[model samples]
Target: MRKLVAFEHMTVDGYAASAEGLGFEFTWRAYSEELSAYGDEHIRADVDTALYGRATYLGMRDYWSAVPDDPAASQHEQVHAEWVNGVEKIVFSTTLESAGWTNARVIGSDVEAQVRALKAGPGGTMQIYASPKLVHSFVGLGLIDEFRIVLHPGTLGAGTPLFPDKSALDLDLVESKAFASGAVYLRYRVA
Candidate 1:
């Protein structure tokens, strides 16, 4: 069976996004070559497709579509952009009628069912990035096989947390890595 992994970077205070409801664009000011390389490698090799909620899908679509047009885009950035734009994007949304991006499919409101089907019939696993509500639903349904929580050095104080509920999850830390940016990556599997 194909695995479903939830990947997100949270702060030391445990918030994925800022209190102002911002994305991860300005969250990590520190740059680590190792982290950048890892992200590039993971997206290109391990990810068969990208799974996202409505908001994330639209945001990524808008951002990645113009990557090639950017005159100042670096070689690595361009490569990463191409890989992400080329991947099969499955967006779960009740409001989205269509997607303008290439290889993008807008799944209907039944996200859980669609995710199950995707997991059952696939080549490689799907990676979901920074979909808080969707991540909560996946966790509640026990659909996520792995959780990659990258803890940044800074603290947001308050924001949308990775896990907002009171459920006591028994997870086993399978892997951990610390980068030069003071970001700690922890991969946890269901125990």
Candidate 2:
């Protein structure tokens, strides 16, 4: 069975994004390093698909698809662009008519069932990035297998939290790495 991995950046205070959804203040400079570790080679070897929410998919598709190939492009950006454009992406949205990115599709049916079916299918692993709402839903369904969280040092007093409502989740720490920038990468498996 393929595993479902949730990857996100969260502040020390647990906010993933601002209330207005304008900024991802939880993101730190070390995030680039963490992301770069999942370059084309790693993604091609491990990740077979991507699951994203409407808002995240739209924003990422627009930005990554429009990025030009220039000398100024950072290695992480170039690798990310390649991975985003090459991998298969499923956008779960109720209002989206169509997806703009290549190898991307819009799913409008039962989210949890579809995701479970996808995990049961023959594949490597499906990765979900920066979709806190979807993550919470999946967590409730006990569909997510692993969580790869990049925790920044700063705190947002009030904003959109990583977890939605109060819920009990028993997790076992799989691995952890701390960077010089006070950003820690923590990997946990659902226990």
Question: Per-residue lDDT for 81-142 in model 2, tens only?
Answer: 88788889999899998987899999888987888888888988898878888888888898
TM, every model:
0.93, 0.89
* Candidate 1 residue runs with Cα over 4 Å from true position: 42-44
Residue 70 displacement in candidate 1 (angstroms) = 1.4
Model 2 whole-model lDDT (C-alpha atoms) = 0.79
Could you give me the TM-score of model 2 versus the true structure? 0.89
lDDT of 1 by residue, 30-142 (tens): 55778888777753357788888888788888878888899898887788788888898888888888977899899886777878888999579788988877788788988
lDDT of each: 0.80, 0.79
- Ten residues in a row with the worst lDDT in model 2? 35-44
Q: Note the residue pairs that clash in candidate 1.
A: none
For candidate 1, give the lDDT: 0.80
